[model samples]
Target: MLSLLIRGRFPSPAVADVGAGTGLLTRELAARGFAGTAIEPNDVMREEGIRRSDLNFPFRWLNGSGEATGLADQSADWLLMGNAFHWTDIENSLQEFRRVLRPDGFFTPIWVMLDTDRDATVQSVDRLLADAIPSFSRHSDVVMKFINSLSTGTSDFSNHRVFLDSHHSEVMSKERYLNMWRSRNDLQSALNPREWEAVIKKIDELLVEEKVVLKLRTYAWIFEPEEIPH
Candidate 1:
């Protein structure tokens, strides 16, 4: 989505992936020729990213929060926050973004939601998450609304663009699909043993009945800051 929003083939140089859990999106940027830094608060997740992801470029892993990025002012050309933005202090994060981004820099927040287009597999995954966790209800709507509000605001940004795409991928087995869900923070921490077992069993049953495939709706917006007079 940002690729379209920025009207560019790849991310800008000097990019920062704030709260880059496990470097999923960071790897994508690195692949696209951006030399980026990752600011992650979770030590375990940061280590996992360093160990697991193939980041060939020289990328610094800063121990920091989105609200208080330790990077210098006007030092970055682009800032990216993944699905983890919902967990951040948005007002503070915005200030941090303003501080770090250059005059014409871009700020992008991305959310990848499973596309529930009446596909049995998509519905199965949705049901598994909804039934397995109680806190799911409170987050999805509120966070989406917050993102929408931030995307709409014009006080800070001179130009902005929004992109929503329906994306799909295939997962061979229920276990493979389950592993993806297991990586999510809320689902991993909240689901009790009984709930987790039940969810997995249900997912297995659904896959057996109607082979599970992954479908997702990815939403992103790129914000270009108003150029500051030197």
Candidate 2:
């Protein structure tokens, strides 16, 4: 995903990563030789993002949301919003993305998720999580709604969809995985203590080779305006 976004692409283009959270994506963009602003709604997360970022890379952090990123019109070369898309007003965000994106720019919402549908371990984990948390939902479920929104969400801008892909995997030590799960404000907001613990226990018990094996795939929906009258 990182390579596809940055491959052969000059660092002169600016990227606006809405709902950027702790700047994980922003840092990745920086490491890829892009200079951009990370807009996060939460002050704490924005601060942490700034602290963790290497400012020498021309990375900037700000407090904002998907609907109103506080960026100038046609200011961003790329508007990449994901991870926190479900937390946003879909329709409003789509409009905002179009507004901030340059005429020739791209807007893509990217997802790096476990291969839940194809991988056995992922399916087992998903089932247990769905059972444990009554409100639990899969990544695919949310993506469908996002895909639908592209056509029906806004009338102001016509979106031309393109498929771009990437994949990778990593082994997660129990301790590291536990910390990640616990640190996610999104999950913490949705899962209670029991539901959360149940998930941890399930994953811990299902570990492969004493660590969680994640077969990950990156998905992106690149949006291009059908016509940009400049």
Candidate 3:
């Protein structure tokens, strides 16, 4: 999506991952040769990022909020928020994003979502998740009109592009499938020990009895910055 929207065969030179949690995308950007800075306010999430990181990439982690980043003015060529933009004060954050971006910089928000049309089995699994964890239903909508309105439709934002990518990964077995469910933030917090165990047991019974893997769809939204008035 970045490649298509930016219209460049290669990646950007420098990027700042705002509200970056666990540095997942930070390291990915760094691995692509972009000098990346991860700004996260939560200490536990930041620590988890550091712990999850390879420690080889030059990822500078900063404790900052999206509304007021500690970065300098017009410093970044690109700003990225992966699955973390919803938690920000979007109005102020977009203003701050414009403040710190160069004249030709871009602000891209990437979200990896589920592909609902792949199979009936996948749909059934999704229903199970929604039933076991109601928040899953709410979290299905990652980007909303109000959230996009914060940064988009402004004179300062430009080259607005939205890309949808669908890739399929097959979870070999029921245990692997259950692990994916267990890793979800919604299920992790919503379900108690016994409840989680029951959910997992139910998943195994469903998947093994039916025989299927999971399908996923990823969506990415990229926006280039227009030159702000002096």
Candidate 4:
């Protein structure tokens, strides 16, 4: 999916994966032969990503955030955020991206959501979260709205087009899917200890009853930089 986004943008794309956690996206790009850098603000996460990365291709791990990447001007051909754009300061990040990207660079933000409608267990888990954490669905909706709004061009970026695409799905075991939920800091932080326990218990039960094969949906919003008069 990511390769498809950067295919024709540059002969050898110099990519920056902002907010890259554990270098998942960075490693993918490197494996595909992209000369790339992974910028992460958290020391622990960044170090872990570096430790886990075993790519033979060129890649750099940096201590940085989307708002302040500390990269050279016009140095990157493509900037990508995989499931981490929501954590960024959008205005500052957009300005920083504009500064670091070449004139023709592309910015793509991607996310993966559990396809709740496709599976009863997934819907049950969604309902459990909705009941346990009031902000779960609301926050998700807000993020979606903010991402959608970016298509109109933000104050800092006046000449860009955001092309939205989705419906790409991947299959995984129920246990792996549940672990993905457990890894979410947002959901964990929102619930009290007892509520968290109850939610997890219910999710486990549902997974067992429903036979636990998850269909995960991937969504990408590709922002193309275009010429605009000031």
Which of the numbered candidates is closest to the native, going by highest lDDT?
A: 4
Please write out the lDDT profile of model 4 over residues 1-230, one tens digit for every residue.
55775776578888999998888888878878888789999999999998887755477889999999979999988998988887887768878888888888888888766655675766777788888877676355666666566555553333454455555455567677678778877888888888787788888777653335666666666665553212
Task: Give the CA lDDT, 0 to 100, for residue 119 in model 3.
Answer: 59
lDDT of 2 by residue, 1-230 (tens): 54565444534788888889888888777776777788998998888887886648566788789999999998988778766776788678877877888777877777777666557776776677667667777556776556455455343323544365566787887677667656656555677788677778777777656576667777666755334212
Among all candidates shown, the one with the greatest TM-score: 4
- Every candidate's lDDT: 0.71, 0.71, 0.70, 0.75
Score residue 65 of candidate 3 by CA lDDT.
79
State the lDDT at 133 in candidate 1. 69
In candidate 2 the C-alpha lDDT for residue 85 amounts to 72
For residue 30, what is the lDDT in candidate 4?
80
Where in model 3 is the C-alpha error above 4 Å?
1-12, 129-136, 142-159, 163-173, 184-195, 209-213, 227-230
Q: What is the lDDT of candidate 1?
A: 0.71
Give the TM-score of each candidate.
Answer: 0.77, 0.76, 0.76, 0.80
lDDT of 1 by residue, 142-209 (tens): 76676566456532332344544447565556677766665666665676777777776776676663
Tens digit of lDDT per residue, candidate 3, span 127-215?
88778877676465545443355346642333344454557655566666677677776666787888888877776777644435566
Count of backbone collisions in candidate 4: 0
Root-mean-square deviation of Cα positions for candidate 2 versus the true structure, in angstroms: 4.1
- Is 2 or 3 the stronger prediction by TM-score? 3
Which residue pairs clash in candidate 4?
none
